[model samples]
Each structure stands twice: as C-alpha cells, then as structure tokens.
Target: MEAKAFDTRLFKRILKYTKPYKFRYYGVILFAVSLSVFAALRPYLLKQTVDEYIKPKDEYGLLFYVTIMGVVLILETFSSFFFVYWANLLGQDIIKDIRIKLFKHMLSFRTKYFDNTPVGQLVTRSVSDIEQIARIFSQGLFMIISDMLKMVVVLIFMFYMNWRLTWIVILAMPILVYITRIFQRKMQIAFEEVRNQVANMNTFVQERVTGMKIVQLFNREAIEYEKFKEINQKHNKAWIKTIFYNSIFFPIADIISSLTLGAVVLYGGFHILDGDKFTTFGDLFSYTMFIGMLFNPLRQIADKFNEMQMGMIAANRVFDILDSDKDVQLDGAKTANHFQGNIRFENVRFGYIENEEVLKGINLDVKKGETIAIVGATGAGKSTIINLLNRFYEINSGAIYVDNQNINDFKLESLRTQIAIVLQDVFLFADTIHNNITLNNAEITREEVIEAAKKIGVHKFIKSLPGGYDYDVKERGVMLSSGQRQLIAFLRAYVSNPSILILDEATSSIDTYSEELIQKATKKITKGRTSIIIAHRLATIVNSDKIIVMDKGQIVEEGTHQDLVTKEKGYYKNLYDSQFAVDLN
Candidate 1:
C-alpha cells in the first residue's frame, strides 16, 4: 500500500474541481469575515460596559449594551449556519462528481491495471477515501476560514487595546505553530498507515467472503480468520498511533495557551500598578479576554490540522485515479460507421511489463461471418487474447485492425459499440429483469427485451418467475441460478446485436441443459456475424469454422475440427481424444 501513495500533483489537479463553485466559496468567506467582525466587537462592548455603564450605576445603558451584545451573538450564529450549509452543499456536490468520474475512469483503465491492483483496494478508494476528503472539504474548510479570520481580528483588537500585553500573548503563537506542524507531519504518516491497513483489511474481507465456499470446502476457515485478525490488529494499532499524536497536540497547545494567559495577567497587572499612561483596568480586561479567545480557536485549528492532513492524504489517493491518463483514449474520430467484422492481428507483441511479452508477434485473420474457437491451457494467454481484442490492453508492438483499419484510429466507443462480449462470470445488476436485459435504458422497449430474451432461451425461465421480466434480481443476480444468470447475460449481449461477438468461456459455468439451450440460441444470434468462442470444453467448439490450439502464447495447431482431429500428432487431436475418452466413461 505504501507503493500506492498518491502523487501530490494529482491531488492538486483534484482541487481544480472546486473552481466551478468559487462563488459559493466566496459567500462562505464573506460570512466568516462578518462573524469575525462581530466576534471582535464583543470584547470592546464589554470594556465599554465596565468603564462607562457599570462605573456610573447606569442600569439603562448597561441593559442597552447587553442587548447589543446579544444581537451580535445571534448574528454570529446565523453566519456560522449559512457558512456551514453552503460549504457542505458544495463539498457534497464536488464529492459526487469526483466519485462518478473516478468510477468511470477506473472502468476505462486497461485490464492490466486490475491485473496488478486488488479490487477491494479500488473499492476502498472509491468509498472511504472519498468520504474522508469530503469531510475535509466541508467542515474542515469552514473551521479553517473562521479560525484564521477570527485569529486575525482578535490580534488586531488585542494590539489596539494594549500593545505591550499583546506582544507577550503573540510570542506563544510561533511555538504553537511549530508544534502544530510537527503533529501534522506525524499524524499524516500515522493516518496514511491506517488508510493502507484499512485497505488491506478490506481486501482480506472481500477475498474471504467471495471465496467462502472454496474456503469451507478446503477447511481453511481458521487460517483465513487468523489472517484477517492480523490485518485488523494492524489497523487498530495505526488508529491508536494517530490518536496518540493528536492527543499530544491539543494538551501541549492548551499548556502553551495557559502559559500565555499567565504572562498576560503578570505583564498587564504590572503596567496598571506602575500607572502606565495608555493602560486602563477596563482596557486590560478586554485585552485579556481577546487574547484568551485566541487560544481556543488556535487549539481547535491545531486539532483540525491533523484532520486536514488526513483528508489531503485521502484526496491524493482519489485524485490519482481521476487524474490518470485513461489508457483507452476515445479522442480519435469516429471514422468507422459500420464494421464488416473483419479482424486481423499483425505481428502484435504485448505484455504487462516491458521485457516479458505475453503475446509474441501474434498474427491472425478472421473474415466476416466466420466463427472461430480459441483453446489453450491455463495461463497460456487465452484470456489475454480476448482482453486485447476488446482493447482492454494495448499492444506493445504492431497493430490490431478491425474491418482492415487500425483499431486505434477509431474512437474507443465507436470501436467497442461494434463488439459484444459474454464472459464466463456473469455480472447482473440488482434491478428488475427488464432493466438488466435492456440495461435500464428507457429507449429500449419492453418488446425488444422480450424478443432478445426469447432468442437466448431465457424468456421462458424469466416468465416463470412471479414478476416475470419485472422481477428483481439480488446483487450479482444471486437470486438466480448460475445457468439462469448465464441466460440473462446472453440475452443482454444478444440484444446489443454487436457486429462482432465474443463468447469468452461464456458457456463454461452453465449446466449441460442450459448450455444446449444456449448452443441452439447462439446459432440464430451469431448468424452472418463474426464470433470468437474461447472454451475449455472442447465439445463446445466442435462446430466452429476453425479451432486454434494455443500453447505458450503461440498457435501450435489450427484447422477445422475434423482436420485437426485427423492430424494424429497435433495438440487438438490429443485434446479431443482426452475429452472424448472422458465422455465415453
């Protein structure tokens, strides 16, 4: 997680999002300034009451002054309310926009990014990290502006009332600021460790939960529990360390403030006793009150300083995603109006790292209306091939051409709009069945959705449900069986009617009955369209126009099923023999 520390430049870029709401920010500042002025006047009114109204036993004048003081207090409260409301509103809006953009940017990232980054850490960044930043932008902003302004006004009033006493009180501020800086740096480090530990805990929780069935089957519950306990313990320790630093900061600030108050009393008392020309008891009292007010906001600001530092750290992490250069840029012209489904990979070499190439000078051609099946052993770059075809990763060398044009030359949306993929792991939203099929597009009619569902043989099952197409599927479609989930996935992809279809182990998870149904539906859906099927089960591709056997990232053997099976020494022949032997048993 330390390796994931966000760049400060990226954090600064995130601050630019606040530019649009500058007027609201100015309103906040104005409110804070008005409150500060009101705060500064309170002491003066008290001084006047002591010197003029109280000294002469003037009850009416004292009552008038008290009423004015009460009015000022009311104004300060209203100003504070408006300041907080507006700042919070702006903060929430900015956070919402940032969250939306960050998610979108992450989705746009190359698949290689996720290959290295954990999904739980990414989720942590989007959730808690964004929230931490939001707190800083909202409450933190109000406190900073109000404290700084109030401090300035208090300083001016203190100096005006008595310069000699003011100097003594102000001297403690340099020490206070130094202490604040030290605490800020230390808290920043501690909280950063805390954030990383939280991410680790989240990753552990997600992995354990998602793989609960596997863990149970393997009888590794105790092992996972210990692992999670260790990560959670680390997070707790980090939190304690952060609180320790924060606790030290406030008490030290309080002590310094106490010492400053003692000094003010000693110095100001001496001046009054010595009959100093400009100092009066009333003025001295007012000066002391103003100086005392200084320490409160100062200590509060110091405490909040830690919060701001923590927030900046979170902001930096979030901004890293927002500011990232989207790997699949759609800046190019949307030059391709329609795809003929011609795909060619020419001398393409690609890898996650510079030196270790996963795809090595690969060459392939698929003509329109051809259905090709790609087969390979685990980690032989089978999934990588599909990922590249979808532009989820870029080729390090050479090119991929769609419809005989370099894929990079077309807008990413335009290129992707022509392709549809159904993955083995089906992803369904927690929404109505119709929304899942049409993907919540109001423009896609209910009739069109049912037609696609029927094409994929899912209409009957969906209709069997009590709500029919309007039925709600729980998160990840947990309400549906794996085969039902696959049926809905097929319908979604089929409904898109993409020019090029990719079935990446799509039928691998479904039951044999469902697979047969899908196999039938695919014939109608894939008619006169280019389709690529990647399957572990060889029987799934027996009807493909060609079957390619990939080994070590290279096509070792390729031909129609009969031709490849007839080649006695070929990899496909061995694969078919092994599966056919299993089927016979």
Candidate 2:
C-alpha cells in the first residue's frame, strides 16, 4: 500500500462504531434540526409582534404581543437544551470508541514500531487528540449546522419584510465569505503547527522523566534543562501564532459587521422619516435586529469552523495509530497440546531488520529433559537464539519445530505458552511482591509461589522484608537489589512450570552467594524439561548435557564440557581456558 499521511479510509472504518449508537445519533440530529427551526421562527414572530400588535397602540394588543414574545423565548430555550445533551453524549461515546480502537491497535503493532517510536507521542495521540476531535464533534459540528439554518431562514424573512433592505444585507455577504476563507487557510496552518509542537513537548517530558536517574547520574542536569527549554520555546511559539490569528479574527469580522449594520440603520431611518411607502419604524427596527443577528451567527460559525479544522488534524493523528498493521497473529486455531520437549532448529536464519541477519544458517537440537548450554561473546546471536525459540521474532529462513509441527503453523499464544524465558535484563512490575511473582493469575496458589521462591532461595531474602511477599517493590523493582530482582524474576518464570525453560545469564547479576543459590535452583528447575542456558561464565555451564559455542551468527562447536575442553584448539576449549586463565591471574 502507498503511504498516506492521513488515511481517509479510516472515516468509513470508524463508522462501524457509530452503528451501535445510531439511534442516539439520530435523536441528536433530530433535536438539532428541531432547535434550528425554533431559532429561525423566533425572529419572524418578533417582527410580527413589533409591526402588527405593538404598533396598533391598543392595551389588549400590547398584552398579546408580550405573551407571544415570552412563549417564543421559552420554546427556544427548551430546544437549545434538548440538542445540547444528546450532542455531547454522542461526541463522548464516539471519542471513547475511537480511543479504545487506537489503544488496541497500538498493542497489535509490531515490536519494531514501538522500538522506533516514543511512548509520549503515542500517549498524546491517545489522549489530547481524541479530546480535540470530541469537542468538534459535540459543540462545533452542531453550532455550525444551527447557525447556517438560522442564516438561511433570516435571509428569507429579510426579503419578505423588504427586498431593498435585504439587498443591502446580501451585498455585504461576499466580503464576509472571502475574509472567512482566508482566515481558515491561515488557521489550518497554525493548528497543525500547534499539534506537532504538543507531540514534541510530550516526547520531551516522557523521555526526561523516565530517564531521570540516568540524567542525574551523568550530571547533565543543566544540559537536560536547556534541551527542555528549547522544546518549551517551540511549543510557546506555536501557541503564540495561533493566538495571534485568533486576535485578528474577531476584530476584523466585527469591523465588517459594524460597518454593514450602520449602513442598514442609516438608510432605513431616512425612509421612515420621509413618510415614503419604502419604510415604517417597526420595519426599520426589525431589519436592523435581523442584520445584527446575521453577522453574530457568522462569527460563531466561523470560530466553530476553526475548531473543526484543529480537530480534524488531531483525528488524523489518532487514525494513524488505528490503521497500523498487526505484526504477529495466531494461526491454525489449535490449542497448545503437551509436547515431549524435543526442540530442533533446522538451518534457521533471522534478523531484527531485513538484510541484517543476526542468526545465519544454524542448526541445533535438544532432547527431552536434557539441558543445552550456549556460550559466546557479546553480540554473538546467543540471545537471538532464545528469542527465536520463544518465537518473539520470526525467522527469515528454515524452520523450528517442537515435536513434528513447524512452530509457525501453531497458534502464537499456544507456542508461547509452552516456553518461559528469564532474560539477562529482568523487568519487574511495580506492585506487591506476591502480585509481581504470581502476575495476578488467580490460578496460582500460594503454595506454588512459595515452592518456586524456596527453590530459587529468594524466599528467605523476601521474608526478611517487612511485609514479605506482600511488600511493595516500587517502580521497576527499584526498591530491591539487582540480584534480588533477578531472583524474583526466576521465581516468576519457574512458577509457570513451562515445558521449555530458557535462562539467559539468569545468575550473572547476583553476587557469589546468590549465584550458588541460583545455580542450585537452576538445576532443579531444568530437570525433566528441555532447557537452554546462555551464559558468559564458563563455570555456570560446566555440567550441561551438551554445550554449543557460538561465534558471529554461527555455532562453531558442540560437545559435553570435558569433551570440548579436551579438544585443544576448539572454540569451547579456548573459551573455557581463557576463563580459568583469568581466574589464575
């Protein structure tokens, strides 16, 4: 598909949400139309009361005229209120529906999308943009309709009362229309600038707040503040431009209206004084009253048009998110069946980005209940191996199989549910210790949590805290040490009791004491399951059933610990010797 800056296709797609609320939308439209009719009728009724009843100079005529005026006021008030409520409700509901779709669509996007885009930009689109669109839908849209209907009705009444005076009002309209068109063009540019500035400012705030610790650690507070000042200045400039245009809009429009109103009054007054068939004081009064209202509606409608334009810009931004494609989806509609824990990767090639393969044409297999260790230098595609097995990213070539079926043929959820990964950089949610460990799954019993914790030996350290498992970990497990966080992550993964377990340097963050405890836990956890252990320390994988040494994107050696060491010039032997040599030094 060709890249579109704003998908016009989204408007039709978004109409699906309006389907459920069609009745409410219809009710709002009916009330709005009804309100417009009432508004249009009132001026004609006022003209009648002033010319026919009030001019007769009878006591009964004055009383009847005042009664008609009071009734018209009451009816207009009711209709105005009638439409406002449902119109607001419609806007709120549509906004809620659009926001939900955008949020869900964002979740379905590829990991690469998130990796490249800032979180703040996404958040701004979800919130501020939706709000702007809602305001236009609710207030601006209805007001524009009401004003246009009222203007049309008033023009007909103006011509009925006197064609000559109506012509005066008509002549001024083209000037008003020309000015409004020019103002709208300028406002659109101003509004777009404002939206872009807001997104940039949001990005600045999100990055600075999230990485505050890093900023402080590097002692770059002054530099960070300067950067923020630059963004803030840009935001202010956009706002000022919008305000400057606004400042001109009302004054210029008002001057035109005032000049037109003065001409109507001046010409009508002369006709009334000359005792000509051209005028009466009542006619002059009604003409000026109608002319005054003419430009009043125009001013409101023009301002609403500006608001609608701003909202369209925001809606376009929000729809961009809703239109993104889903990167990974389930297939074959199969439930995850139990496996014999056999895993084989047959000459798989993969990359984070196209043409930049991280794992190139490699094959490996692990037997049921056996532990396979992978060791290599940093950036040797070791972590990529675990990611492929977990199906976090799809391979570019070849296939990975569990039992006999290709992994891609299985449902994504089914494939992932069978595998558990403990990454080197463990992330813990900010919540109670128990919630973080159990991940709020009601199915996991306290006994299961305790068992995993005890097996990992973090249970004792957790108990030492004031609230034990109920203790709050603060943000990103910041309250606990890195080793403590890693231990809890291990417990979290093991508690799931997955058929395949991956420990990617799980104990590397821990101290000597925690390492020994975790090593023991690792052995217990890997038993009776297919496990892949990626480690930097040679001692950690010394007793694995098989060891694979990786270099660049290919596996260079595979054998048992001693067998690999016995091969004097092999990759695994070289790695093992270098580690011991560092210890001896």
Candidate 3:
C-alpha cells in the first residue's frame, strides 16, 4: 500500500475500470485541456486590450477586445461545467463496477476466508474505502492534471510577453515546490494513518453493535463506552496531523507567490524607467494575472496530490482482495443437478489452520436415504464432517465423493444446491420472515414458503405474528425467540428439498414442544433423504440408523443405539449414561 512518487502501474489498473464509460472518461479530459487554454487565453486577450487599445485610446479597438474576451469567458464557463459533470459521472461509474467485482470475488471465497477475516473490515473495504477512490476522478488525479495544464499555458503567455519576467516566476516555483513536496510526504503518512483508524473504528463499532446483547448481558456498557471513546480519540488525532500540515503549508505557498509577483512588478517598473522598450504596462498587467494563475494551481496541486495518494492506496487495498483467488471455490466443469445422496469421505484430512488437523484421516460412508447420527463431546469434530461433506472448506488430503464420483468433479454450485443445513444458532437478516426464509430467492414463491413452514409445523406460529409471514424479524432474528428463529431456519432448509439434509445441534436449544414438532418434521424430511445429525443430547439420536461415538477426532464406537448401549463402558453407552444421569433417566 506504500505509494511511490507516482504509481503508474496502480493508476493504470484503476483506469481499466473506466472502459465501460469511456465516452464520459475521455470527455472530461478533453474539457480539462480546453478549459486550461481558455483560462490562459483570457489573460492574453486583456493584455492585447491594454496595449493595442487602451494605451492608444481607441474606443472601437476596446469594444472589439471586450467582445472577444466575453466570448472566451462564455466558453470557459461551459467547459468548466461539463468538466465537473463528466468527471463525477466517470468516477461514480468506475467505483460502481469495482464494488460489484469486489463483492462477487468475496462471494467465491471459501468459508475459511470469512472465518479468518473480520466482517466489519470487509464492509469498510467495500464501502468507505471505495468512496475515497472515487475522489481520484472528481478531485484528485484529473483535477491535478487540469491545474498543471493551466500553469503550463499561463507560463507560455508570460514567456511570450517577457522572458525575464517568466524567469522570476520560474525562480519562485522551486521554493513552493520544495515546500509542497515536504507537505505531500507528511500528508501521505497522515492520510494513511487516517484511513487505518477509520477502518479500525468501523470494525470496532460493527463488532460491538452485533454483539450488543453479550455486552449488555455481561453488564459491560460503561467499559465498552470507554473503549469506543479511546478509538474515537485516536481517529481524531490521526485527522489533526493532516489539518496541522495544511495550515502550515498554504500560508507559506501564498507568501512566496506574492513575493514573486512583487519582484516582477518592481523589476518591470525599473526596466521601463531605464528605457527598455520591451517592458510595457500591458505586459505587467498580463504578467500579474499570469503569476496568480501560475501559483494558484501550484497551491492546489498539493491538496489534489494528497487525494490521489489516498485513492492509490485505497485502490491497492481493494485489489488485494480481488487478487486472492487461491482459496476461491473453483467451479468444475462437471454437473450434479440431482445428487443421489451417496456421500463418502475417503481418508479425508483437514484443518482450518495448517498442520493442526481438526479431522484426521477420516473415512466415512452414508448410503443414499440413510440417517447417520454423530454424537461427540465439544470440539470432537462432529460439525467438521458436515462442513467437509458440503465442500465449504477444502480437504488438505484425500477426496469426498457423491454417488462414487469425486465431489470436486461436480460444479460447486450444483453440489451445494443439493445440500440443506439447519444450525443451532440460526442467522436471519433484517427483513420480513418470508424473505429470510426464502432468502429473497425469486424462484421460491410465497405459497411455497408457507407450505414448507407448514411441513415443519411452524406455519401456525408464524401466522400468529403481526404480519404473519411478512413480519420483520430484525437483525439476526432478535425480534423472535431463539427457538422461533430455529424453526424459521428449519423451514428454510425444508423448502430447498435437498437430497442431503443436516441438523448440526439443530434441536439442542429448542423448547420441548418445538422440539417435538421438529422431531416430527425431521422424520418427515429424512424419510428418503441422506441425513447427517450432530448432537450432544444422546436421547435425540437413539433412533438413528447408525450412531457414531467420537472422541478427540476419532471414532470410538459405531452401531445401532441398543447395540452400543449394551456394551460395558462403551463410548456410546458412556455418553448415554452421562445424559441419563444428568436428567433424562
């Protein structure tokens, strides 16, 4: 993210996004040049009036010059308007494209990526940081180019009138340029600091708000508030350095500009008194206007360069995410439009982090339409099996097969579409219950949603809400009880009509009545589908076609409930007895 004096490569990459709107893109640039020419031309026209008309006392000549100058002003005004309009339009279009590409890239990433990265950090990159990149067109890169063009044209006019005066302006430029270089270097560091703090603040606020329930439940309101204040103070402190440098640099730039102008005036007057025929009042007048024009752009360049620097750095950050394709879900050429639901894991091994295996040398097979229940202690790798089966994260070694063919051979989308999952901690969006259930899938009709909910025995409860199916659930379904959200998640999985259904601690938190209803729903849905159920409650898995008891990522027992229960001190019997001893007996 460190930008050199000028990063041509990064700027070129940013420019690639402008291809879709090239008309506006090039139109803005053309306007920049025309406006600069117009700006330089006006001062020269006035010089002509002062020398060829005013000094000669020619009224007709003055009228003609006035009319021409007015025409130039009119053109400059229109050009300026178009320049601003096209520049902003081009900027907005580019960012819109970049944001879309970024989001799509993120969507293709494996769950491993999201597991490691903060959601708030991704949000900042997608939203605010991209907005800064837009400033490059509207106020940063192009604006700097336009200003430099203005200075170049103004210098041409000054040199054409009197070379010695042009020399004075050039001599004054290095002082201002030197100061600006120092200012820009300092500001780049400050702006980077500002961006980093902004991202930090966004991440902190988002995480706290999302977990406000935990914060309040733990009585940490005052502690959280103090933490927020500290972050806020750091954010302000980063901004203050930029403001301080700006306050110091601009005044110095102005004083140097004024001194240059004063020197030109003094030298020109003496030249005229010494009988140098080339120096004239008209020349002095034009040179004064040219000096102001020259220095004004120089002053603005410092600010514009800062904007460009920020945009470049922001662009680099965005590109980092785009280039991270190694972990993206690769779409295979093979298709699995309909899964036979025969799942197999042959010597599968994986870890979220390298060399730390969560599932080691795992081999599993579930015949089509069989229901397998996995019972384990916490972190015994029960859920890891489900994740591997779905290809949410890739295996480090070996392969998963569906219908005896490699799962990776199937197209990723087609493979996932046939699997539906309901988790213990259900997540719902801030939307109506209908939208949350269907996830805004246009293909899933409202009637279909109702039917699925009815199948899961939650339709009556949903209808009991104020808006029935239309009731807004709010963030993470906070408006409803945890059991109610679980019901909605169950309904979501049911509506998919997947070949393979998974319940990962799905009924662990359900109330007795809801649990009974879901049990009924579970039987109905799992009747002819391959099902994987992970549970801590041993009672819930008693009817499983096969129950696998695991410990420390290895299977210790596998059998029907009665067979394992009869074994003395067997893993399954131990778990069953522990639960019975706790309450169920």
Best by TM-score: 3
TM-score of each: 0.92, 0.92, 0.97
Q: Could you give candidate 1's per-residue lDDT for residues 15-71 as a string of tens digits?
A: 687898889878988998998888888998888888789878899999999999999
Candidate 2 overall Cα lDDT vs. reference?
0.81
Question: For model 3, which pairs clash?
Answer: none
Give one digit per residue, the lDDT tens place, for model 2 in 180-287. Answer: 877777877878889999999999899889889999999989999999999999999998987888798889888988888888888888887887776667667777
Q: State each candidate's clash count.
A: 0, 0, 0
Clash pairs for candidate 2: none
Candidate 2: segments with Cα more than 4 A from true spot: 1-16, 287-289, 326-332, 463-467, 583-585
- Give candidate 1's error at residue 465 in angstroms: 1.7
Point to the candidate with the largest lDDT: 3
The segments of candidate 1 whose C-alpha lies over 4 angstroms from its true place after superposition are 1-15, 266-281, 284-288, 326-331
lDDT of 2 at 438: 83
Q: Which 10 residues in a row give candidate 1 its minimum summed lDDT?
A: 1-10
